[model samples]
Target: MIDRDALQGHLQQLLEADRFKDYGPNGLQVEGKREIHKVVTGVTASLALIDAAIAAGADAIVVHHGLFWRGQDGRVTGWMKQRLAQLIRHDINLFAYHLPLDAHATLGNNAQWGQQLGLVADARFGDQDLGFIGPVPDGLDLPRLSELVKRKLGRAPVVVPGDGRPLKRAAWCSGGAQGYFEGAIAAGVDVFLTGEISEPQAHYARETGVAFLACGHHASERYGVQAVGRHLEVNLGLQHAFLDIDNPA
Candidate 1:
């Protein structure tokens, strides 16, 4: 067992939360017991995740996404009230790392998702600091790579080709980040990929002539936090299990 405060401190340091520019706070959100043994890790700490943690008799739940969104007030009411009620009733600590998980060179969503897609991982890039691009080699056609994406993510992507050419390079940022397509274009990647696509984003992809793929917002992001949890269990000697809360979006 490990002290909750100490564990959060360790994770914050390991993630180097301050190193990357992000949108939300990255660290411990709700304090609970002094020590924790069983931890449930997931992509997002929604109601389903919290319930799974409680059912599994976990001491804490750690996630890539958590409560307290950027502009959201701290007031817990309505849905937030019910969410926090579950945690408080069960005395389960919640640790969240938003941008830190997204930007980490190894365990971040970008790297994990890239690894899943059979892309050779590299350092993160661009203003958003979401993730890095992959060189798909000179000869691989877009269709084959799309199949690979489907194989990895378990969902055929909504693909739109920008240019009438075979793919040479591609970039990925898991989750609702169609905003980065222009950067992918600027980086000269033949394709740009994200989780969910916006209507405007689809138009931009068609207009800019960049091959765009939306694998899934939730599906593309399940690996990194699980990686972190496994690392913690193996390295720190804690009992950690990942609880997947099915989110279609």
Candidate 2:
């Protein structure tokens, strides 16, 4: 068992959560048991995930997406109230690490995802250093790279092929970061991969001759939380389990 404060402090230091200005608060979002023995990690703190964690007898939940975004309504009501009620009633702590989780040098969303797809991440540039620029392994063209992405991520990414050329340098930012494609293009990457695509990204890819791939946001982000959970089990000696809820988007 570990003290909640101790766990939070360790996580804050491990993730360097204070370095980035994220939309939602990092670390403990709600107070729960003072001591924790088991943790459940997931991509988001949705009602289903919360219910699953409570059912699994978790003392705390570690998630990539937490509540209380900067622009969201401040009042607790509706779905927010229901979610909070479950946590408070069960006395389960909610720990969320957003941009910090994504930007970590290792065990981060971008790093993990890039590694899984065989991309060697050499640099981080773009907003808050959340974007990763790297080189796709040689001999992997656009078609082959798309194939690898779909097979590894278990979702067919929407590919906007550019120039029909072999992809070399690539940049990726997991989860709803299509806006950073311009930055990737400026970085001279042959392709940009992110979760969630906007209408304008298609045009940007075509105009700039940079390929675009929209892998599922949830699919892309599912790794960092799990990696952190595994690290917790090893580093903190806490029991950890990753709860994956399917999200088609």
Candidate 3:
């Protein structure tokens, strides 16, 4: 077992959580037990994840996404109340890292995704360095790259081909970052990839000739939380398990 305060401190330092302007609070959204034995890490802090963690006898749940977004109503009623009540009743400490988790140099979602795709990250630009730009190795085209993405992420990407050219450079941001496409285009990358796609992005891809790939948000972001969990296991001597709650968005 580990002290909750110590763990939270280490996580804050490890992630530099205070450096980013996030949509919600970054740590300890729900207070639970003082001692944490086993930790359950997942993409989002859904009720199902909480129940699963409780079933696994975990004292804490760590996640990338958590309750209480910026625009959400402050009232604790209905579904929010139920979710919070469950956590309070079970005494599961809820720790969430938002933009910090996505921008970490080594353990961030974009970095992990880049590593998996064999892209050597050369630079990070766009919002708070959330967007990653890197080289695509020789002989990789849109179709071949899409296949590789499918093989690695276990989900076929929503692909929009551009310019009918060999892809040389690419940029990406994991988890619903289609808004960064313009920045990637401005960076002169051959392709821009993100987790989700909007209606307007399709037109941009065609007009700007920058290939766009909508990799599954959940699939793309699975690595960061797991990476943090593994770090806790190896460095902090804590038991960790990753629970992947399937999200099709």
Candidate 4:
């Protein structure tokens, strides 16, 4: 078992949480038991996940997305109250790492996603270097790449076809990062993949000849937290469980 503050400090240093300006605070967001033995990790800390952690006899809950965010109503009412009450009542610690989890070189959502899809990341781009760029296998076109993504992620991607060009290089940023499409295009990649797509990206793809693929947001980011959980289990001698609550978006 590890002290809650120690665990949080280790993670903060490991992920370099201070490097980026993120949407919300990184590291421990809620205080619970001081000694954390068994941890439950997930993509998001929804109420369902909190209940599952409680049922699993977890001492701590670590996630990519935590309950609190910037600009949210300060009042903890409704769902927020329900989640916080459960954690507090159970004495389960709550920890969240947002951009840091996404940007970690070896244990990040983008890195894990790229590795799972068999893509070798050679460069990083976009804000805080969250985007990755690399080459696909030879003879792989947009259609073939889309099929590969579906096979690996277990969800078919929404595709915006390019000018029928042979795909040479690809770039990606997981989880609602269609905003990085233009940046990927600027990086000279033939295709850009992200968790979600907006209407304008289709037009941009059509005009720029760079294909666009919208892999499911949840599906794309299912690996990093699992990776971290395994890291803790193997290296820190802590019991860890990654519970994935199904999310189609």
Candidate 5:
């Protein structure tokens, strides 16, 4: 068992959470039990995840996406009330990491996704260096790379074909990062992958001859929190569980 503040401090230091101006608070969004023993990690801290954690007898819940966000209604009511009440009743510590979880060199969402796809990252780009540029395997074309992504991520990505060239290099930023497509193009990658795609991205891909792949936002970001959970188990001697509430988006 570890003190809740100590756990939060360790994670803050580990992920360098304070360095990024994220959309929401990065650590300890809600305070509960003072001592955290078994930790439940998930991509989001929805009501379902909280119930599951409660069922699992968790003392703390860690997630990539927490309940609170910037520009959200400050009042705690409705679904938010339900989630907060449950956590409070159960005395479960709630911890969350946002951009930090995405940008961490080793235990980040982008890094884990790249590792899963066997892509070796050689450079970083985009806002806060969240984007990764890497080389694709020899002679790997857009179609083949799409298939690889589908197989690994368990969802068929929406592909916008480029100039039908064999992809030499690829760049990616997970979770609704289609905004970085142009930056990836500027970085001279043959293909750009992200969690979501907008209408303009298709036109950009067609014009620039840089392939675009829209992997599911949730699918792309599922690994980082799990990686952190395992890290806690190994390095901090804390019991951890990753309860995935399936999200198709």
Candidate 6:
């Protein structure tokens, strides 16, 4: 069994909430019973995942993406109504960590991807503090790496080559970050990978001479939430299970 306060506190300490400027507040939201046993972790707090958690008899659901966005209204209606209605009915607690998970050196999406694809490169691009951007491992080109990413992430990448050069330097943010065009260019990364893209990304890829790949946002982010769940199960002696709610993007 896990105490809610203790678990939240441990996560706070480990995730370093103060160090990250996150899209959502880190730590527990929608508090429930003070004592917990079964924990369900997932990428997003979508309806499917929440339903699974309730069915699994989970006291709490930990996720990378939680309910409520930056500009969303406080009113509970429509899709939001259904989601909150289900959770409140079940008395299930929701906990989310966004940027903290992305920035975690050992357990983050960017860092884990960095280990698999790129060698260590000091953990940052420049003044930007959101995610990892660096070089691919030795002697590999873009096409081959794209193949690997397709295999691992189970999706074909939408590649846009800028320099038409083989890739070594690259930047990555697991989810939708088509907005980071300037950051990747400034980092000197020859390529960039993200889940979603816009028209401007195409223009930037052409102009900046940086290769771009859209590899599906949900696919790329699945890793971090699962890793953190397993870590919690091992280190904190909590019963944890990861529920996969597949999304194409």
Question: In terms of lDDT, which candidate is strongest?
Answer: 5
User: What are the per-residue Cα lDDT tens digits for candidate 5 across 39-135?
Assistant: 9999989999999999999999999989989999799889999999999999999999999999999999999999988887999999899999999
Q: Which stretches of candidate 6 lie over 4 Å from their true place?
A: 116-121, 126-128
Model 4 per-residue lDDT tens digits across residues 1-249: 998889988899989999989989999999999998999999999999999999999999999999888999789899999999999999999999999999899999999999987788999999989999998888787788889999999999999998988888999999999999999999999999999999899999999999999999999988999999999999889999999998999
Residue 69 in model 2: lDDT:
88
lDDT of 4 at 17: 94
In the predicted model 2, the residue pairs found to clash are none
Clashing pairs in 3: none
How displaced is residue 130 in candidate 1, in Å?
A: 2.0
What lDDT score is found at residue 14 in candidate 2?
95
How far off is residue 224 in model 5, in Å?
0.4
What lDDT would each prediction earn against the true structure? 0.83, 0.92, 0.91, 0.92, 0.93, 0.81
Model 1 lDDT per residue over 1-249, tens place:
999988988898989986866567778787777789988899888888899889898998889888887688878788899989988888889998987887788888888888876676444556656758877755567888788888887888999977667677788888877888877788877788889888887787778788899988989889889889988998889999998778878
Rate residue 208 of model 6 by lDDT.
Answer: 80
Error of 5 at 243 (Å): 1.1
Q: Which stretches in model 4 have alpha-carbon errors above 4 Å?
A: none
Candidate 1: stretches off by over 4 Å: 137-139
lDDT of 2 by residue, 79-194 (tens): 99999999999999999999999998889998888888987688888988899988888899888888898999998999999777668799999999999999898999999999
**Looking at model 3, which ten-residue stretch has the lowest summed lDDT?**
160-169
Q: Write the per-residue lDDT of candidate 3 for residues 1-249, one digit (tens) a residue.
A: 789999999999999998889899998899999998889999999988888898888889999999979998799998888889989999999999989889898998888888888887799889899999999988888888999999999999999897777788899999999999999999999998889999999999999999999998889999899999999999988999999999888
Where's the lowest-lDDT run of ten residues in candidate 6?
119-128
Q: Each model's TM-score?
A: 0.94, 0.98, 0.98, 0.98, 0.98, 0.93
Mark the regions of model 2 whose C-alpha exceeds 4 Å error after superposition: none
Higher-TM-score candidate among 2 and 6?
Answer: 2
Error of 2 at 127 (Å): 0.9
